[model samples]
Structure formats: structure tokens, C-alpha cells
Target: METSFKIAFISGKLGDVDGVSLEVDKWIEVLTGAGHEVFTIAGLYTNPLQSISSDKQFSLEYLRFDSTLQHHYEKMMFPYLTKHPTHLTSGTRDIIVEEMMVHGKELSEDIFQIIQDNNIDVIIAQNTNAMPMTLLGGIAVYNLLSEYKVATIFHHHDFWWERSRFSQNRIEGLLNKIMPPSDIGSEHVVISSYSAHILSSIKRVIPTVIPNCENFGKAAVLDNYNSHFRSDLGFDKTDILFVQPTRIVPRKRIEDSVRLVGMYGRKYPEIKEKIKFIISLYQGDELDDSYIEVIKNLAKSEDVDLHLISDRVSSVRILNNNGERLYTSRDVLVNADLAIYMPKWEGFGNAFLEAVSCRVPVVVSTYLVYKTDIKSAGFDNLEVRDNYDDEGLLKIPESILIDMHQILNDSEKRIQMTDKNFEIGKREFGFKMLSEKLNTLLDSYSDEIRASRRRLQKSKKSYAV
Candidate 1:
């Protein structure tokens, strides 16, 4: 019989306009290409409007988590928990446990039934185990995995420990149980060496490092895109598009991007009217209204041509009722003159990878992850430090503009840089590179399965005899 594993890629929200959604879609492409049927078990979805048909061998069930309900529970309960390095009191712990059990029972039942009904061989629990966005969802997945002994691959993108928002919560005990279980019949995957090392050190769980990869082999053709996109956005053909392909979050440091462009525009009077700094995503995490206002004030003061185009962009391409084609984020990257990725923290920095894949020169900030891990790998780009004084800011953009002019002027130099970056990326973050590591992991997983099955058989025989 032909052996094809039925894989359920589970997440909090699978089909949204976010990095996680983009990453999951890429994995589906890889999994489906490898001949495994891919399905999504998500809180929300924005792609492939129809669920997996019953006639098809694969299936995905949507376990919708009500955002309003989650918000209510969090507001009602989270305040009483310890903040910033959250340790819980006995009273709060009891309440958290009660809620986990209540939601876990229903979640576990549904998951178990789905597994049995579909003969699911394994589950790729994406970030749900790492992030406590849905505490009950984690509990449910944890309970089902333990009771059924199902093979699970917990693909951790970011851990709750890495974020400040989850610093103090009443769910520490539950988070410990599920935020990646450290036992034999399962495997774990982390996106970066930094995460892998930290998780192993903290939880004593060895996880395989699978860096997020991009497909650069397929060239990004820019035929009608430039003209069409320019016309759509009301930009002239001569306009210099400086794209900040990230959300308007505090951590993203979008003000720096606006400043970068504004400084450039001011320094180069010849291109003053042509520079446009476009932020492609909507406002994020309303907790930091001050930072949002800072970006606005900075842009206004610097005379930056800022465009927040969140309303127009989405994860998937679609034609509206009026026959307007909505473009994906990839389209934005393809047409960008330069890409800015100046985030304070990133697990793997997929935006950097995307920029390189698009063959665009980038201006990056020296984020901790990049400084410690990526710099040593020998990938070269126009980069700067975090702190930017007035003089320093003025100098940095001038240098970048000169570099972009050179990159545009010198075809040989541009090719050399792109080629070198591409090779380095392929060595580290290419799909095939990850696939090789995954293949070995799968070998180990198969051995684990065989050993487990034999042990169960021996126990059964011994009891029978």
C-alpha cells in the first residue's frame, strides 16, 4: 500500500494578513509538493475559501475561536495574575486550571474525533504550542496528543517567554504543560538557532532548527506590475517607492523607516517630490498609542510622503465585485525600490529573507537576533545601528541613497551582491536546505514510531500470555 501521511497544520489564525499566515501557506506548498496532503485547523482562514472536500483524501476543520470571547476572558481574568515574569497565586492558578479543563474537554473531544475519523498520522501544531493566544486550544491539543499517543510536530515560531505582553499571566502551569511537551513520541521544530538553544536550555527539549526559506530560483518578473501598480496608487512612473513591508507596530519601529525616507528626500532635492514611504499593514496593538503618534508627528515634521495602504492589501489575490484585483504582499515586495526591515526583535526575520529573494537592496537595523546570528553568516547589506541622532540620521540616508544609486548604476556589482546573498540564503534558508534537515528528522521520527509500536505490541502480548 502507498503510504501518504495526513497532516493537519494547526494555528490560531491561518488565513490572515500576517507573517504567520504567509509562512503557513509556504509550508503547505512544500508539504503538498512532497506528496503529503495538507489541511488547516485554524481559528480563522482567508485562503482556499472551500474546506477540504470530503471526496478528497485530505481534510481540515476550522475550530473557530471567538475573538470577543477571548478578549472578555483575558480582560476579566488576566489582571489578577502576576505581571512581567508571571508567577501565579494558588487562587489564580485554580481559576486558570478550571477554565483550561472546561475548554480543553471540548477541544480535546473534537480533535480526537477528527483524528480518528480522518486517520490523521501526525499534526504540525504551528505556534499554538508556543504562543498562548488561545490557552484552551493549547490545552486541548496537549490532552489529545498525550491520551492518543499521536505523533505531533510542534513547529514553534515564537514562544510566550519571548514577548512582554505575556510576561504576567495566570496560565504558567498550563503553559508549562503544552507550550511544547518534551517527550519521545513527538518532535519539535524552531525557526532559528537562537530559539532552539534557548528552548533547549530552558525546557531541556532539543528541537530541530528549520529556518524559514524563500524560493528565489523562480525569478520575480516585473512586466506590467510597475505601470499597473503606479496607476493604481496614483504614483507617477518616476516616483521612488520605499516600501516598509511590516505592520505599524511599536516593535516594528516604523518611524525609523519614515525618517529614513524623509531624510533621503530632504537630502536629495532632485528626488524630493518622488520619494514615497508606504506602510502596507494596519495599526497594531493599540496599547502603545504614544508610539503611533510619534510616527505620525515624525512623518509630518520630516515632510515624509507616508501612505498607510492596509485597506487595499491582503494575504491572497482576489477580484472585488467591481473587478479590481487585490494584490498580495509579495506584489508589494516585487515593485519596491528598497525594503526597510528595522524591527527590534524577530525570531527568524522572514522579511529580510523576502527582500533578498526579491533581489532588492535593504536597509536593516542591527536587531539582536541579526547581530548575534545572521551577521556571522557573512551576508552583506546596507545596515545601521538602533540609535539614530539627528546628524547620524542625516548621514545614514545619504549613504543609503548613494548605495542605491550605485546598485542601480552598476549592473555587475548588483548582480554580484544579489548572487552572493542568494547563495548564502540558499545555504541557510532555502526550501531545499530545510527539506534536507526535515528528511533526516522524518527518518528519526519513523524510527521512533516503529520503536513505540513494538513496545506497545510486546506489552499487549505479555498481558495476553
Candidate 2:
């Protein structure tokens, strides 16, 4: 009979710069604002918690990506990282599957305890069933949902099949069963229409599309604390700061950003020396240091002043143990002259929304989701074709370079373009839109629960007669 419900958000990691973490934060904000009790359960916490109380937060070590069980299964399933044999023997495969069941059961028990303690009414599994980053975690959630009648919503951002690295795995059977189990009595949510179409084709179940949203009401500005971001990051006052606010992952195609800057420098040699390309976020979710090296070498060859300042960036501003100031991602965006977001693929563009919300001009690649779901929103940005050259770098259009030059050099043009973009972005992807969609989804679930209870009562009375 209660109007509000206690909700629990479960994920592999939370309070970080990744798209999933940022989206989860926005969901928590909207849910709490709607008078619902929210709780967080994550395997790892990279940043401090802001919205959820400490008493309501739960951390499980076995569910972490770096846990011994996860590493063991990953190496066995996807053996590209290590020198181990690519194909597992049938007997060895069976043993690994048995171990998975054992560990998964333990994890499910632990998770159920938290659910019972908090009297949670719904569980929002954040990317757990979509990606195999934490294999046991996915199985555990599936098992928990199978044994109990706890309402759930699988908020899938990306699926394992989308990534080439997870394509040739030895655990196909297990992945098919629990990576995203179709039989679970829960709602499904995807970030884009493309993802929803794909999920329907694969799982035969239609998903509700919920595009990622931003808090446009509290736009970042050049405040007193963030005014010194440039000086603190060692950038000269006259330098043109072009920020790549994404992780150093392969799909991001950061080399393309470096190449664009290099081409822009050649076109206008006068300002080449004053250009600074800054990659604000850290390396990606996967284990790959060679890609960072590749970017560094390419930057050197292109003669770009590339700076990796992830050490001083966090979800929120704080001081490190060494007494150095750590700036939030908003601080990096507020001071940027232009944002370069040329990812080859993205579930949805969180960095794009962040830049637009901050009133910064963006140079975005026309990725699939961008073309399908976002471009029609009428945001004015310097667009790059997603086509690539034989060298595996994005093909930068000449017109993009010309537009970039104008936006970077002319103050009035920059202000007009960015202001227009901010209004369009806020109108399309603001918190109010998300809050409305979420409320509707929750209301439907509440109706289903009442219908289910009525059916149970009718069946019990007939059986007693």
C-alpha cells in the first residue's frame, strides 16, 4: 500500500568517471528526489559517495573485477591476454563451470542478505548482465532473481557481443544463459534505440529505451574554485585547451583527435605553438597499457602538446594525500575551449551531454547512436564523418577544420554556437525528461505487482474450496 519503494542499485563499480557510474548517479538523484529510498551496492568504489548514505551502501569484494575468481575465469574464457592455451580442454571447462556455480551461489546468498536487511522492493542491475566484466556477479544476480520474486530492472548499457574482445570466449553456454537471462521476471532498459533493436533481435524481448540524461539545471560555470583549473593543470593562459573527456580506450579513437589537432596546426601555423590537447579521464575498463603508449607516440609524431591529467581528476573535487588538489570532470569541461569526442562506438554520449551542459563547443564523430538517436535533436556541433582511412585513423573533413578554426578564434561565434547547443541539449536530455520516464516505468511495475497479488488470492480461494 506504500506509494514509495526502497530501491537498490547493483553494479561492479560506482562513483567513477565511466558512463555507467555517471548515469547511475543521475538515476539516484532522480529517484531520491521522487521520495524513494535508494541504496547502492557495488564491488568497488573509486570515488566518495555523495547521495546515498553510508549505512545504505554495501560493498562486496568477491564481486570486484580484480577479484581472484574473476581474473581466473576471464583468463580461461578469453585467453588472449595471457600465454595460456586458447581452447580449454573439456574436463577443464567442466571444472571451471562447476567452480562458477559454487562461487555464484555464495555471491547470491551475500546479495540476498543485503536485500533482506534493507527490505528492498526493486533491484536495478547496472550492466551486470550485459558485460562479463564480473562474470560471477552476473551469474549471482541471475541466480538471486531466479530463486526469489524480487522485482528487477536490468539497465544494460552494452552487451558482450558488441565488443570484439568478448566475441571468442569459451563460456558461450554460460554467457547465453546468464549474461542476460531472458526468463527472469524483470523489466529491461537500454540506453539507445539501436541497443533496444539489437536486444529484441537477440533475446526476443522488447526493451524500454531510456537515453542517458544530464542535470541541466545545475550547469557548470567558471566558479572561484574552478577558475584556477588551467593554472593548476600547468596550462599557459593563452593556450587553446581542446579536451577529450573520455577514457583512453581503443574505440574512442583518440589518435583521430591527435590527428585532427595536427592537421589544424598545419592549416594555421600561427597558433600551432599555443594549442594544448588534454585527455582528462584515465585508461579504460579493460587491461591494456599498449594503447596509452600508442597515443603518446602518435602525439609526439604529430607535434601536439598532449597532456594526460587523470591523476588530478575525480568524480568530485578533493585533496589527495600528498596535499594536491583534485578537480572534478566538470572543472575540466568548464575551462575547455573545445571538446573533441570522436569515439568509434558509444552506448550513448555522456561526455557530449556534459560538454553541451557546460556551454562548450564540441567536435563529435557521427557514430551510429549519434546519427540514430541524438543528431536529430538539433544541437549545433562540428561534425566529423565516421569514415576512417587505411591507416586506421578517423578521416577528418576539411570543413570541420575550417569550422574548428572559426570557433576557436572568434569569441562571438564561439559564444553563439555554444549557447545554442546548451539550450538544445538541455531541452532534449535534461533531468525532467528522465524523471518523467522513470516515474512512468515505476508506476507500471506497481500495477503489475497488484495484478499478480490479485491472481494469487483468487487461486488460493479456489484451491481451498
lDDT of 1 by residue, 1-465 (tens): 333556777776766666677677667766666776766667666555233443432222323444654554555446532233344578876885686578766776767566555556677787877876666677767775687576778889889877776756666666777887776678899988889889999889899987777766654546664336667877777777888888777778777677777777776778788888888776632246666688888999999988877766777667667776566666777778778888867887877887788777778888877877677778878787766576534225467767766775587887788778778876777778756776677666875544434444554456553
Worst ten in a row by lDDT for model 2: 451-460
Question: Could you estimate the TM-score for every candidate?
Answer: 0.86, 0.95
Off by over 4 Å in 2: 83-87, 448-465
lDDT (Cα, 0-100) at 225 in candidate 1: 46
**Candidate 1, which ten residues in sequence have the lowest lDDT sum?**
54-63
Those runs of model 1 whose alpha carbons end farther than 4 Å from true positions after fitting are 1-3, 49-66, 80-93, 224-227, 283-291, 386-398, 408-412, 449-465
Residue-wise lDDT of candidate 2 within 12-48, one digit each (tens)? 9999999999999999999999999999988998985
User: Which candidate number maximizes lDDT?
Assistant: 2
- Residue pairs clashing in model 1 are none
Residue 248 error, candidate 1, Å: 1.8
